[model samples]
Target: MVRTLRTSRASRALRTSCAARPEYDSAPTGGRKSARRRTGTAVGTVLALIAASAAWVVGAAPSADALPNGLALTPPMGWNSWNKFGCNITEQKVESVADYLVSSGLAASGYAYVDIDDCWMAGSRDAAGRLVPDPVKFPDGISGTAAYVHAKGLKLGIYESAGTKTCAGYPGSLGHEQTDANSFASWGVDLLKYDNCNDDGTSAQRRDTTMRDALANNSSGRAILFSLCEWGVDNVWTWGAGVGNMWRTTGDINDSYGSLLSIFHANVKLAQYAGPGGWNDPDMLEVGNGGMSFTEDRSEFSLWAEMAAPLITGNDLPNSSAATASILGNRDVVAVDQDALGKQGVQVSAAGGLDVLAKPLAGGDVSVALFNENSGAATISTTASAVGLPASSSGYSLDNLWSHVKTTTSGAISATVPGHGTVLFRVSTGSATSTGTTHALVGASSGRCLDAYDNETTPGTKIEIWDCNGGANQKVTLTAAGELRLYGGTQCLDATGAATTAGTKVELWNCNGGTNQQWRPNADGTVTGVQSGLCLDVTGGDQPAGNVNGTQLELWNCNGGANQQWRLS
Candidate 1:
């Protein structure tokens, strides 16, 4: 009989927990209200003044607030010293990486944070029960090191475990949330990657939320990006949005091709669970680590970029090889990873050890990756229709993202991918249209069609942009009740809290014909919010594809741009 490996058993653990944040209240200021009243005279003027005041009051308070600092709008890109240096981390080493990130053009390419992973902490807590940097390894202490990193225009990230002792037997933040949070903030820590080792009986929410509240309510007023490194013990992806900006969804990845592919296969299924301010992390990247071939390394980076995963490098940045620098410094690949849409790629079709994945990009394009799992080269092919693109009489245009080459094909895209290698393409169709009675709403600016995030039919599931694959999540129908109903469900697209001003997030809820759910199409290719009379505009005003994603659908005054232009079907 075979025994289960510790890693395999740990991967199977799944549980649940709950936590809450304290409420905050603020009333409108007296001076602003008095100024509005002084200008009121006629009955129409009085009503307008009262309406403006009410709107102001409503806008002043958040309805269902989650994050306090509201940072990490996109998946973070940085360098993590774990897979390479591990417990051998030193302050001088971290400082050198910071310097190299700026000098070697990685920081300029959008890789910012320089994170010092585990073992940088002392063997024990201080007299006040607060964490202390290892004096021997970090001679300048965490504060001085943070100052040095800040001076280089790069943020600093520190690591800790949620239990009494970290994985390396160092003091953790189990029962000293307040003290540790304050200490980190005072030390100028910009981000925290909290692990879950040694957490014997602690609930996921109990352990993680304690730290989240401590950081959010810290006295220093420093906003730290919380990265949950729980190793997927509780299906963290299910409820991580309200807990942290990013959460690890797999076991630790070692510096090998097997480890990389294992983590990728595990985390790829969680695409819909990720969005702006929240991400599904497969753990830190192992790029440029000298374990995999250059081809495999390219495949790894390409897949991560297509998935919109964090681009954290875990290699020795200062002594990087020329080939490694080329892979990490490719601006085009980085663009796909940092796309403003923030949608993760999804597996569209798979068969015979060959898989085809598609990612809907911002500029009306789709990124395709043909991956082969075999040990030898294999031919893989998929048609445009199979990936949700309507057939075009003029055919499809293709761009090899890795090679930066452009070409056109009539029908199916076929390529011979090497063993464990990938062929990535950006595909677009010309003169495309749909004839169905009900149509999927596709953002002309984002190219991503409207989607019910996570494919969940629950009320309050946010409506977001995802790779459009002609699934039920992208289908919607207009009803006689003046409501746009989600296809195959009783829910309508409802604005969160019925908010009227710009930036009100849209979600799916029960169909009640509420004014907030009413939308009408205008002749100028704009969708008007019936209650607010504002155009439904894409957040970033259509700044071309591959710019930034996570720009939510908001209400703005009618402006004729591709962002506000919604192509039905």
Candidate 2:
């Protein structure tokens, strides 16, 4: 059973906590894969694992190599079977997807696993009581299906429940964990989605444990990629170690930006638990599902990739449009997920609903995810300097992992992303020189960068983006502009600038430019508005109009609130 990450056929899959729950139901598109963690001893019975090394603490994140599984599955990248199009799955759909993955060269690019989520099985079990394939649906049966997939140079995957019925109300693994695991192995199933649905808090652990034990025991000769699908209840981080290849660490993900932000912020602290044989899953990504803006999807993909979460595609493959595939096909971003060392990124800063995350890879290159979780446009800004990098980080090589563009960093860096979008970058740890044409920001023409909002009204108001001509609205500098200027001039972008701090207002009166507008970019990836000095609040508005002169702004602590995001372009 010892092997590399099922993804690479070269390394391994990889591990976290949190109590955030979600409203559970189904609009019929399918269901959300689900989170939490538990404890484990750092010590291990190495005799059993010839292909791996040191054991990981259930809840405690082990240093790089200390993870039970090798760094094989970091940044696991593949297409899911939900989202853009839900469970309207078909055999031909998977085949076509396999075709697309191979013909399109995506499989070689790391989209190796073609997974069939729940419902691929029939409504009835075989006479033996094991779940059966919907022969009418999967005419070739899973084994044939798997053979077909493997023929296309891809691996095959399928889903099951640890309950009496799958999330779709068909057969499950509940009382038949061992039976199902063995059956899956028999069917040539390489990956298993052992879920915890139909099980509440008490039964959740029981379901996960029983299913994991079954999968491990049955996966004797061949390696099986195990994905534990319990919504992070009872702190799965402490209990998930060595339980599966990757386990869900949060509630089901929705098509909304807030949903993604909530999960992403929650995963930062649990970053240490991820590595090789196990990982902390943030549920499946909702990219290309139209549940969120392209920006939000980018944010979703980027952060998850940076966090080394699984790349389980949750939409119907054939039905997935090119845009959806494009999201899944990003190689640079995928590289962060498929990084050799496999480390999940941690949030360095968040405010105005913008998140700054960074993951260290095998080489000196570092993967950074700049996520805009807001419902509207935001100019998310942060510099390598803001993330505790040495001041020498100023001119590091900045490559846009998403756009696939290479540039250089400046004293700081700023990226503008639309609602829900993200900008991912790989920063090389080396000296950089501004070629004027090569820097991502700044030059002889960039002048200065700033965001102006008269956030003196209620929170969640329209946050306006503007050019920093040093006018009254944009004349603020990074220092005490003189004195307190609590919410004045242009609109309220509150003076204090704490990302997670809540409750401040923006007002526009004059531009005496006090500490309210004299804020500095904190090393934690947060921005200080300087005027009124409060962190800029998004006020909960989903999409703000650009250059709106009377935009009302509120202030709050800087926990990456969407309103607090600003770029100096």
Candidate 3:
């Protein structure tokens, strides 16, 4: 979506009297708030301040007040108009797209909503102060369009701004929230994408919460899916769960590989903030938009599904290429996105422009994505145990979502992915289990062993690397549950803080079967943590002299350095 304000005669006329100034229509880059001046009338300003203060106090922690509208239990899959058609949308275009969604089998695969983005409304409100549909663009009006889409067993979504004027300079619903909401519900709108433009400097939480309440208490009592487009400012993901069904976690995404990669890096880290009723939106999909290659487009779809992001397509459906149709229509990939488990995938391994993501499913299955962000083909690999599966000696099944090829691996899952390409797989572990083999883990570089500091045997004792003297403290067992057990299985190697990031300290903790304590001894002689997907390093792995005795072990990116390599002996 274009970020700058679009000034039409109608928008210009309306802006002349409002105290609020024009800003970028899209979210500010780098998660920074816009610098545009904000102003409102005396009463409006005072009330906004009060609401901001109240939200700041009550929203100090993540809000649990997610709308109980019972929609978007899984990220809503649909087609939006902003990315492709932009302000060129029309009733015929929307209706045609709805027909294509059904005829092309997209709706059967879960692409249900046909949403109209910005510029769908008239330049000004009607005489009764309610928003009006653009006469020329939506000739049948929103209600008529909704009826047509509903007749096809699909839903209709509409857009509005939470400011005095929309980014496109049309009248917004800032102060006219309830009135606009009543209009939307009465018109059969099933969803609302609320943008942030020409805002009055009130806290984003306050503005979004106001609209959330208005939609909830609207006179029609319709259950409208709330989508917040604040562009990630004010840390929307922190408390967005209670405010909207989904909240944008980054700026608008263009049809480019760089934009997709950048947004992926930003949104993937916020997996903890997304779940059943709420989700972290990385903006709509730009697949089939032609800015990126077919490989890149597929990568975008795979990564979004891997992240459990809302699969709202922003491309023209009728004229899309077969490659686009195949990518978007892959039921296996879509299943991962619509998995009943509702868990967002976490990046288990990322190094040298190669990344591996793993998401657990509801029925003992796991979906993994091996993404190569480099400019050339690269072989990316991860073990079954590394992706939260038990090290099954009987092997695990890997179903390639894109290729429709099935393969089995004893433990290793590897693929040579092209540049900007993704290898998506659904891994299923049968009855295989980890072996209870006990051995001293000898560091490949230091020739030292994994040890509990000072033989403390405490829950939080530091796990370090020391001389391999066959001591009891150095003996570790690989348990069936994917844990490294010490002291006769009493203590397990744990990534402190349950952290998934690198440099997390390894500690001795009681085996509670938490993912943080899961360890996988890979065939490459590297001991990796299932939770962090990081290697058990001897600290300072890149040092020239290698690690010293008593150097505490921490989780670090798997760089194949000697310090990160371990041998079970």
Give lDDT tens digits, candidate 3, residues 1-569.
Answer: 34532333233222221111111111101111223222222112212222221110001122255557777888889999877777778999999999988876678778999998888888889899999999998889999999999999999999888888887788988899999999999999999998877777677789889999999999989999999987777788999998899999987788889989999999999999998778999988887676776577878999999999999998777665433565676677788888877889999999998999999987778999999999887899999989999767678987766544355788888987777888888899853323676777765444457888877897899998665556778888887788889988888999998998888999999889999999876533467889778988888744533445567899998765546656455
Instruction: Report, for every candidate in turn, its global Cα lDDT versus the true structure.
Output: 0.69, 0.55, 0.77
Please identify which of the two predictions, 1 or 3, would achieve the higher lDDT against the true structure. 3
The C-alpha local distance difference test score for the whole of candidate 1 amounts to 0.69
Tell me the tens digit of each residue's lDDT in model 1 across 371-450.
88777878889888877677788988766554333456886877767677777877898632221235576554444557
Number of backbone-clashing residue pairs for each candidate, in the order shown: 5, 125, 0
Candidate 1: count the clashes.
5
Q: Rank the candidates by lDDT, best first.
A: 3, 1, 2
Query: Where in model 3 is the C-alpha error above 4 Å?
Result: 4-65, 431-569
Per lDDT, the best of the predicted structures is 3
Candidate 1 wrongly placed segments (more than 4 Å): 1-68, 390-393, 430-569
Query: Cα deviation of 113 in candidate 3 (Å)?
Result: 0.6
By TM-score rank, best first, the candidates go 3, 1, 2
